[model samples]
Target: MATPSAIGIVVSDMKKALAFYRLLGLEIPEPAEGEDHVGITLPGGMQLMWDTEELIKSFDPDWTRPIGTRVGLGFECTSPAEVNALHAQAIAAGYESHKDPWDAFWDQRYAQLRDPDGTVVDLFAATP
Candidate 1:
């Protein structure tokens, strides 16, 4: 069996994408700005990588942007309040919110936001 090592994202705007992830507490290095590719390692040793669209086309000339949401990443917050706070912070920073924070029937406080590349990012915490 193969182990998954990293999650890769193809982004149209590197700066904007990096900024959004940075706000989420990812420690992407500042020097990654303007680069064609960038990445950061998560706490569990899994890597999250971002590559510019042009970089993808450089090798795969037939590459095309996917329609709608092709990927979704879920982030677990320490508490329900943190979920709401981060959701509001993301929105206030000009990012798009897909769904406001709410208590889900599944017993989690959840919210959704769109990354710069239109990826669905979910924030959640166990409801008390």
Candidate 2:
């Protein structure tokens, strides 16, 4: 039987991204001294490896440069307040909001933001 493994997000600045995730309450494992990458363990043993261009380009010949895009990652929360709080935090951190936090007909409070690198991040909090 085949199973899904871990997911990796390539980052230009590992330290900054690690700190951002840490702000979201994800436990970032200690980086090996002087290492360019960091490992974070997600629930269910999923490992997210933050890799640098030098590392990824080592494997691919056509490796260009790292670029953040409008396309973003999504996260789920427990309550609308949590979503609103995260939106506020992201905005306060200089992220531009694509959508203000509001309840959706789909039964969640949802909002969007652009990360430091311009990656769009969507946060949704489920309703009771």
lDDT of 2: 0.68
Best by lDDT: 1
TM-score for candidate 2: 0.47
Pick out the ten consecutive residues of candidate 1 with the lowest summed lDDT.
1-10
Residues 1-128, model 2: lDDT tens digits: 11223455777777777788889998887677656657766788755667766665654456566455312366766678888888888788877987788777658787767667666566776688
Q: Which stretches of candidate 2 lie over 4 Å from their true place?
A: 66-128
What lDDT does the true structure give each of the candidates? 0.78, 0.68
lDDT of 2 at 4: 29
Compared with the true structure, model 1 gives a TM-score of 0.53
RMSD of each: 13.5, 13.1
